[model samples]
Target: MSNVTSGDRRVRRHLTAEIKSSLRDLRNQLSMLNRQVGIQLDLKDIDMDCLDLISRHGPLSPSTLARRAGLHPATVTGILDRLERAGWIARERDPADRRAVTVRALPDRGKEVYRLFSGMNSAMDSICADYDEEQLKLLADFLRKSTDAGLTATRDLSASGA
Candidate 1:
């Protein structure tokens, strides 16, 4: 029905496979990078991720952190305990809600973590500079869609008890 030929389909399939492979490789590399950073910071993977989330989203309640991290509230409690013990974060009473508490990142600890990633951030910025505005916008869109798909797959797998 369409004008596409067998050769075109084959090419498309090959490109798709390559893209999948590249994405997997990237994910693995990022995991390894996180692991290395965690070790350097004397923190666990989840601990580092928690710090990142806090840094990005500002102060958050334990329940919100657990939801964002895809972790159980009790599990997040332990993680928060560890982070608090390590002096990376502090638990503060919410000013607007006296009954609630929120976690905030310690400035010095956050700065140290940011310093660890400064080189990588610089490199990524350099790479981005090579792309024009249109190309950068397209790349941003692709990344957003890919991230959403990944989150959906994670939810589906978790629901299936996989």
Candidate 2:
């Protein structure tokens, strides 16, 4: 039989609760940060999400971006127009398919967005400095696993019609 005692179980529960609370609160804090960034840049929430997607995995087709962002193709067209007008992104012909177009974030314009996120990035760097290489690796692994779990849960929920 297992040798686990009640006191150990209580401590484990407390630790798990604290970690869960931190995770939930962190999501809200990140959302707030994004909102502030959006406000300063005069962009919408969906625009920020789409922008990040393009910046990270870009030179993507507008249709691909719309699918990823869960926005309608017509709506994406308006957003692309706005972003182009604001000098945030550019639309270029897809070399592989001359009839199609892809969107790309402007590197020079990206610097402004990074500038706004610098505070959080610096703080994260400072936090990482407190951990040794092994510990940091463990944390990174845990985070990656957690993200995979979240994606699985999201897919399951969608399948369940939730």
Candidate 3:
């Protein structure tokens, strides 16, 4: 019932492969960048990720952080311990929920971490400037879809004990 031909299918497959390859490269590069930033800050990769999450999402409970970071609650506790000790994050008692504590990134420390990526941010801005609004919208949509796919894959793998 479809008019799609073999050549069209092959082209689509090739483009998909290219996209996957680029995503892999981008992930690897980001991991390397995170490691470099961690070393510069004398923090572990997970610590950096935790700080980033708090910086982006504001205060979050430990359980919420664990879910967001794809980490076990025990592991998140350890990360929080380190971040707290380093003055990168602070735990505050939730006013409405006395029993729950939320983690927040220290403003100065968050700015310090972001300083490391300032150049990359500028470069990304320049790259975006090369595209027109319509093209940029398409790119944004693709990235959002890709991120959702990645999150789903992560959940599936975790559930499967992989």
Error of 3 at 159 (Å): 1.7
Worst 10 residues of 3 by lDDT: 108-117
- Listed in order, each prediction's TM-score against the native is 0.94, 0.89, 0.95
Off by over 4 Å in 3: none
Cα lDDT tens digits, model 1, 39-129, are 9899999999988998789699999999989999999999999999999999999888899999999999888888888888999999999
Question: Local error of candidate 2 at 12, Å?
Answer: 1.9
As for lDDT, the candidate ahead, 2 or 3, is 3
Q: Which stretches of candidate 2 lie over 4 Å from their true place?
A: none
Superposition error at 97 for model 3 (Å): 2.5
Show pairs that collide, candidate 3: none
What residue pairs clash in candidate 1, if any at all?
Answer: none
Model 1: how far is 107 from its true place, Å?
2.2
